[model samples]
Target: MTDPALSELTPEQAQMAARVRRMMLIAGLTTGLGIAAVFVAIGYRLFRSEGSAPAADVTATLPRGARIVSTGIAGDRLLVTLEVGGATEIRAFDARSLKPAGRLRFAAEP
Candidate 1:
């Protein structure tokens, strides 16, 4: 409403105008927050770099009949699943250093 109209507003009209103003204020704050979040994400990506990675030597020799089933990265570890003979073997390795972290074997119950 125009300034002249607002000056002659009834009580109910004034209440509705106040509600509309409050909604506009909330919308402005939400938009401002969304913009700030995008800027922060851009700054983080530009400032953070891993630099030159160190070369790590790791060699694993699987059994004659073993074959890799799947590979994935979880957190800081690399998960390697292999079907060796009749059992399922899962090996965890440190992603950065390529060091063997742990191993697990699952066999079917006959």
Candidate 2:
């Protein structure tokens, strides 16, 4: 008996081969999409996560060597103390307006 491997295929056999080729193409595309999805997930995990500290919507950073020593509220008054250059300065502000009223400066040490 002759082998069938190298023989010319019939019409039905050719159609089956075409169908198999289409199925393999679809499978290849689906696998490629899945791999891309995995890569996206890994990228999101590696580069898009929250860092150590939460982000601030607004920030006001005082200059170096200046420290906010205290804060107080009296009725409609706001008081804040800034200690800088070995001196403590007291500042008064209008609480409602959030504007400076007056400040008393203390002499700094030599």
Candidate 3:
């Protein structure tokens, strides 16, 4: 079937329309490729852990009196809850190296 829109356009107008369509297609493909590259980079970074230690020695890194209550992973950080004396402490560490980043201690109830 003939396209009514194409039949209505002059020869010059048809050429311009074709050029615009081609430009839009190129632009869309470029945008898609850019987005795909970003996602691939993110995936590579997330999964790349070669040459690093198989496991982090978390227990050895804890304080002498601290006892691990729970453990979890958050983004790039490791979350470890410890019971130190009578206080509940949340220790945050670098997930890859197990290096201590910071700690949060809950105050004892009155």
Candidate 4:
């Protein structure tokens, strides 16, 4: 038996073929758009800068006889508890820049 030509197809078959082609075209377009969106998102993530790069090494100077008691991180700040002489102190530094944010000192009442 010979294969039927496009012109020889029944009306219903031609309509079904046309509908299939349209569906395929829509599916291809949606797939292409999804791939393009993924690529764009990846590119944006790679190229966008959130903030300045952190320093490689940071050095913090302390007063004479000052010793570190403990260290911790709170949100974007670095907290360091220190014992200086006979008093206790807490210092906060920016986690990214390593710059001093604030300081709190505790001393006994006279």
For all candidates in order, the CA lDDT equals 0.91, 0.80, 0.87, 0.93
Q: What TM-scores do the predictions have?
A: 0.51, 0.41, 0.49, 0.56
Candidate 4: where is the Cα deviation over 4 Å?
1-6, 50-55, 62-92, 101-110
Better of 2 and 4 by lDDT: 4
Q: What TM-score does candidate 2 get on C-alpha atoms?
A: 0.41
What would you estimate as the lDDT of candidate 4?
0.93
Model 2 alpha-carbon drift over 4 Å, by segment: 1-6, 54-110
Pairing residues by index, what is the TM-score of model 3? 0.49
* Ranking according to lDDT, highest score first: 4, 1, 3, 2
Clashes of each: 0, 0, 0, 0
Off-target runs (Cα >4 Å) in candidate 3 are 1-61
Question: Order of all candidates by TM-score, from best down to worst?
Answer: 4, 1, 3, 2
lDDT of 1 by residue, 1-110 (tens): 46886579898998999999999999999999999999999899888966656887778888899999999999989999999997899999989888889999998887
lDDT of 4 by residue, 1-110 (tens): 66566449888998999999999999999999999999999999888957677565988999999999999999999999999998999999988888999999998998
lDDT digits (tens) for residues 1-110 of candidate 3: 99897679898998999999999999999999999999999899888946566775455466779899999999989898999887899989888887888889999679
In model 2, what are the clashing residue pairs, if there are any?
A: none
lDDT of 3 at 66: 80
